[model samples]
Target: MGEWIQSIADTYKAICAGEAPWVALGNFMNAWYDYAKDQREALVSESLPALATSSLEQRRWAAFCVASVEYLCQRYGLHCPDWVYQSQYSLVEPWFHAVNPHKPQVRARLIETTPEPFTRRNIYCGNKMFANKYEFAAQAGTTSPNQAI
Candidate 1:
């Protein structure tokens, strides 16, 4: 897990440095898809305990890694055609977490400004959005019809 996270962080750093985000996203996505079934299960069944117990920094890094990859994937129009993300979609949360971090205002703007392919409709906001209407609802008070705060 540490290695995977490190690899992801490195990838994000590379992307931030303007070094072909698609290449990193592709490599990371390939690794993820290789073990996605196990990872999907671990996200809910096993790894979550560790993730939950991890320091906020650790969790934050994890979230950043996930978000970076997902964002790059979307930016490059890469989709997880094989990874269904069926295990409660826990992996999806990090994308939002990475985007929002601690600022709800930015989170809201980022969520609202996100393009169609990256919007809540496509990603379901990890079920964070309560209803379809609230998905696009102005980010107010954390919880909206489309998402749960």
Candidate 2:
């Protein structure tokens, strides 16, 4: 397998092995940014459905897997695979991507701010939850006074 594919597989394995969903998602997003455009398209159209389906069968982190894939697809303007739209991928209850001591107010705010892609899957997180370093750099551009010569 290609390195990008392997990296994504490793991230998925980590998620299945009990890594925190948000942390695994960060790792996944970083690896995703490294994928070439064709690879990214293939990943979304071919590979992600298997991973999401496996997570669903495992009955652990299924919502996170589906929502993360859909979120990435939406961000990049890719076509989300049909399996992601199945009823099984949607969580029966809302899952707030928060740590212990999850505050009710925080959950409320997340519910308010989470993007449609995630909210539809019943996965709630900050609107910027998927932002990565590459996105930050792109947004920063070269105009910052602090940029090195």
Candidate 3:
């Protein structure tokens, strides 16, 4: 896990240093995929800064990073802290769905700092859903049950 994170961090450094497109993107995506396979939640959270920095007109890659994080959070029962999600919206909005609706913080500074009226809801609730899903799975004793995660 440490090695994987180091590779990702190195990729971020390369991107910051203006590395070539293929090397930077390939390294980032490779590291991200490995982390996802390992179900490393903290690394997933930690990767956000690098991902935000590494998003260089590669909108699809940016979206990939976001979706990967969301999926891992769901898989591993890791809820992003609210403040962290708050920070990321300044970079880009995460993925969305019908059940989750945007919520704008009413604090004066929050409103002043962000002109956008809303941020994605459930930004931190994915892990709770994951845990519930796990518990349900445990109860069912099989993976085929009809349930939401």
lDDT of 3 by residue, 1-149 (tens): 55545333354455456676447645544444443445444454455344444443443333333443455455557784333344443334443322333554333333333212132321222222223333465677866334534
Q: Better model by TM-score, 2 or 3? A: 2
Q: After superposition, how far is residue 52 of candidate 2 from its true place, in Å?
A: 13
TM-score of 2: 0.71
Per-candidate Cα lDDT values, in order, are 0.41, 0.64, 0.42
Which residue pairs come into collision in candidate 3?
A: none
Report the lDDT tens digits of candidate 1 across residue range 39-100: 42232222112233454434434344454444545544455332322232233343443344
Error of 3 at 115 (Å): 23
Give the top-scoring candidate (TM-score). 2
Per-residue lDDT of 9-100 in model 2, one digit per residue for the tens? 45556677778756876665655775444567565554332443464423436665667677788888888777667776677767787664
Q: Predictions ranked by TM-score, top down?
A: 2, 3, 1
Each candidate's clash count: 9, 0, 0
Scored by lDDT, model 2 comes in at: 0.64
Cα RMSD (angstroms) for every candidate in the order listed: 14.9, 4.5, 10.8
On lDDT, the leading prediction is: 2
